[model samples]
Target: MPDAVVIGAGPNGLVAANLLAYAGWSVEVLEAQPEPGGAVRSDRGVHPEYVSDLFSSFYPLAAVSPVLARFDLAAEGLRWSHAPSVVAHPLRDGRCALLERRVQETVSGLEAFASGDGAAWLNMYGMWSRVGSDLVQALFTPFPPVRPALRLAAKFRAAGGLRLARTLALPVRRLGDEEFRGDGGRLLLAGNALHADVAPEAAGSGAFGWLMSMVGQSHGFPVPVGGAGALTAALVSRLERSGGVLRCGERVASVAVRGGRAVGVRTAGGESVIARRAVLADTSAPVLYRELVDEEHLPGRLLRDLERFQWDFATFKVDWALTGPVPWTAAQAAGAGTVHVADGVDGLTRFASQIAMGQVPDEPFALFGQMTTADPSRSPAGTESAWSYTHVPQHITSDAGPDRITGRWDAAEQEAMADRIEAQVERFAPGFRTRILARRILAPTTLQAMDENLHNGAINNGTTALHQQAIFRPVPGTGRPETPVKGLYLASAAAHPGGGVHGAPGANAARAALGHCGLRTLLHRAQRI
Candidate 1:
């Protein structure tokens, strides 16, 4: 029997297993997929010469994660690469709002839009500089993070506690309107906000937008040098180095619960593996509750609550092996690793509104990635490997556009949506389609097939909206990794701190398990006395 059994080889599960192994616990991570990496995988599917990130590419969150820092992935052969500019939003008029690595450069770029907007940008960065590191710590730790919370409370007091809270709580649109005179700062904030499913008009979007923008400013949205898989490879290597075992293609059938506690897991192959210490699940809450663990092992409240658990918007992606590069009308977009294609802030609002109404957006707001620009190793020389993703409603009731795209995501719908996305890209980068040597379309169902956690291509697993965050995440309960069942933990993005490449949920679960074991040992010693 291994000391612990991890039921996924995704970054979170790998991180949890690695931490346990590092602490001298024998660990085994079973992955359902043929290969690991979950949403962090990369492949040459677009072309044999191009490395296209299968799901996510950027590593800004990973760069700043204290949890990931413990493993020291850099020593395990993980190298990060950045583009000339972090992100760009091109206007139809050819003026682009760019976010550069240097704070002053970002400030200068914003100032071109309006005089005082530069100062506004500086002030936001100044706040991030003050609380950013501590904030990261607080975010990575489990909820009711006592020490970090106290430290942040002190810092928050100094930063005008209540006032700062109100400002951060403001809707991104309102925050933008209050801070900057022109579109530059607003576009940056709004575009970043859209990175999550949160709309600009949402209550907590300002904080999320500011957080992503600050993350980009502080850490220039780095990508793994070779491919996104390099980061996953580093994690796997570290886990193996520390004596952890990973078995891919081992689909966990059920959690073996002898009493009220989890004891081990049964695989799809009818193989039973014993976990003496704990079972850390890196799957979604729905999967864990409804499928893996039997209904008898769960509380009625949890089962009911799972019904209301909201998943973010379904994702539609198109990956391309460009012959040269995206021919952008706006020059700034060429150097950017990430380009946000939208008409304006109003256009973004319209897109979000359409999705909310359960309509296929007429014009999708594409988050386009220039992978080769960010990391040259992603493709052959002079050629670009690129992909763009846009949100569609989970259940489409109507088509806001003329294409009549229902959410069936059949070949016809898939092809139509891909064309629509390409058209959006073409809006900013004229003749973008001309450069595509090959393209791969990953519709919602296709994405889910590759990574089960990305249910319906909901990247974050659960919604990042304010109501579902913190203590309320996964379900309304203590925002810790520990579950109702003993010796089991929810160690996926479904837990507190929601989604990101950061392994906070896994690290939190590992720490919680360690603490439980320590406490149990202490109790046994006390009983003997």
Candidate 2:
């Protein structure tokens, strides 16, 4: 019997397995797909010589994640490449708001937008520089992160801490409106926040925006040198070096529980692997509770709460093999790794509102990533690899409704939706459509089909709203990786710290699993003696 059996070979699952293995626990990781990396995979077969990041590209959080920092991926053959600017928000007038690596450069960029906006931007960056490390440590660690929280409080003092707390809780829209006098800084914050399911006007959105923006400013949106998959390869290498085993193309049918304790898991092929210590799952909460564990095994209240679990908005992504770099109206945008294509901050908020109402806006907001800009080897010298994605309502109208595209993301509908996204890009980068040599579109259904974690196309695993985040994540009353099952734990993005490329969920799960396993080992040794 292995000390631990980790289902799913995503970042979190691999991280969990690595930690367990490092702690002298024999570990095994099972992946349903032929390859690992879950949402962090990459491909070059789509277009000859063009490397495209299948799901995720940028790694602002991964760069600063305390969990990942411990691994020292650089020594494991993982190299990061950063673009000149982290992100760029282009306006209709061809002016672009850039977030640069240097604080003063970013300040100057913001000053161009409005007077005193530079100072406002500095205030936020200043706070981030002082307490950002503590904040990152606090957010990424398991629930009740007392040490980091206390460190943050000490830095802010009593009165300043209260004020800072309120600032962190401000909605992105309010933060932008209060801190910025022009469209540049406001759009930057709102766009960054929209990376998650949270809307600009929603509570807790400001924190997301602030965290990511500061991360980018501190560490320009870094990408793996070869592709996003390089990071995964590094993690897998570390895990294997630590004596963990990884098996792919194996689908877990159900988690086997005996006497109310998770014993192991049975795969679709009818093979059962016994886990002597713990079973760490990197699947969604619903899949673990509703499908893997039998209803009779769960508490009534927990079942009810699982039914109410909310998912984030679905996403539609498009990858392109470009003839050349995107011809942006704003030259500064050409240097950025990521660009936000929208009317402005108001346009983004409107798009979010429309998504909330289950209405696909006429003008969609798209996040464009320039792969080759960050890593030139992504494509041939004269060509570029690019991709973009936009969020849509999770529950779309089943049938054709007034002024809607049926919301049924079939090939035809997907093509039409892709056209709209392209049009949005063309609005900022004129002649963008003409530059595409080939393109592939992944609808919500396609994305979910590609990765089970992206259930209903909700990429963040679950909603990141204040109500569903923190201790309330996965389900209220239990969010510290441990489940009601004695030896089962959730080590996926659905856990606390919500989503991102960070490996906190996996590290936290490993810690919890090892704690009990270590105690049991001592008990067994005593019994043998």
Candidate 3:
């Protein structure tokens, strides 16, 4: 029997398994998919020559995450590729707002829109830089992060800390309105916030926008040289070298519980793997609560809390093998790894509103990636492989609203929606359609089918709103990985620190298990002796 059985091979699952193995515990990882990485996989099947990331590509969080940094992935054949510019948002007037890797350069770019806006950008960046490292350490770790929190508080005096707290709690719209004097800075912040499900007006959205922008400025958004899967390959290599085992194509049907404790898991094929110490589930909260765990194992209140757990917006992604680069009117956009095409802040607001109202915007906000610009290895010479994605309401009905795709996400409907999204991109990148040699569209339904973790096409697993975060995550008062079941723990993105390529959730879960298994305590006692 292994010390633990991890029922998922996503970044979080793999991280937990590797940590346990490093701690002198025998760990086994089981993945439902043929390969690992979950939504972070890439493939060349879309076009025989071009490599396309099936889902997630960029890794801003991973670059700054302490947990991932400790792994030293570069030693395991993982090389990161960065573009000249971190992100570019093109306007209708043939101008683009570029967020460069340096704070001064980003400020200079913002000055073009408004005079005092440059100062505003610097002020925001300054705050982030001062507390950024400690904040990242604090937020990504387990809740009630005392030491990091105290460090951050000391870094900023009482008044400054209070003000910083207000900024973190502010919504994107409000934060932009208060800090920026021009559309340039405002649009950049809002676009970054929309990367998740939080709307511009939603509470606690300011943190997401500010963090992503500053992180991008500090470290240009990077991708693995070969593809996103390269990162996964490196992680798997590290795990194996640490004496861990990864078993793909093993679908865990249920987490076998005995006497109110998780003993092991039974696979869909009727194979049983006994876990002598712990059973960590890297699955959605609903699946773990409703499907994997029997009714007898769950508390009524916990079940109700899972029922009330909200999810992020459903996503629609399109990958293309292009003959050449995107023909953007704004020349600077061509050099950017990621591009945002929309009207402006109002455009993003309208897009969010439509999704909230269960209507798909006729002109949606699209996140376009110029993969080849970041890494030429993604395609042959003079060719490019790129992708774009946008969010929509989860439950779309046939008669949802005006300009909606009927919420069914069928093949014909998906194609029509893709056309709409292409039109949005074409507005900024004229003749964009002409550059495409082949295209693949993954609608919301298709996305859910591709990965079970993306329930209802929600790529983030669960909503990251203020109410659903921290101690309230998954459910109020159940923030830690240890669950109601004695030996079962939640280690997926559905847990705290939410989604991203960052491996905090997995590390936290492993820490919790190590405590229960007595290895961590034993090590502490031995060091003291």
Specify the highest-lDDT model's number. Answer: 1
**lDDT per residue as tens, model 3, 309-377:** 999998888999999989999888888899988899888888888888877777889999999999999
**Alpha-carbon RMSD, each predicted model:** 3.1, 3.3, 2.1
Q: In each prediction, how many residue pairs overlap at the backbone (N, C-alpha, C within less than 3 A)?
A: 0, 0, 0
The lDDT values for all models are 0.92, 0.88, 0.88
Report how far residue 70 has shifted in candidate 3, in Å: 0.6
Model 1, stretches more than 4 Å misplaced? Answer: 519-529
Q: Single out the weakest 10-residue window by summed lDDT for candidate 3.
A: 520-529
Cα distance off (Å), candidate 3, residue 102: 1.8
Candidate closest to the true structure, highest TM-score: 1
State every prediction's TM-score relative to the real structure: 0.97, 0.96, 0.97
The candidate, 1 or 3, that scores higher on TM-score is 1
lDDT of 1 by residue, 364-444 (tens): 999999999999998988999999999999999999988899888899999999999999898888898899899999999
Clashes of 1: 0
For model 2, the stretches where C-alpha displacement exceeds 4 angstroms are: 398-404, 519-529
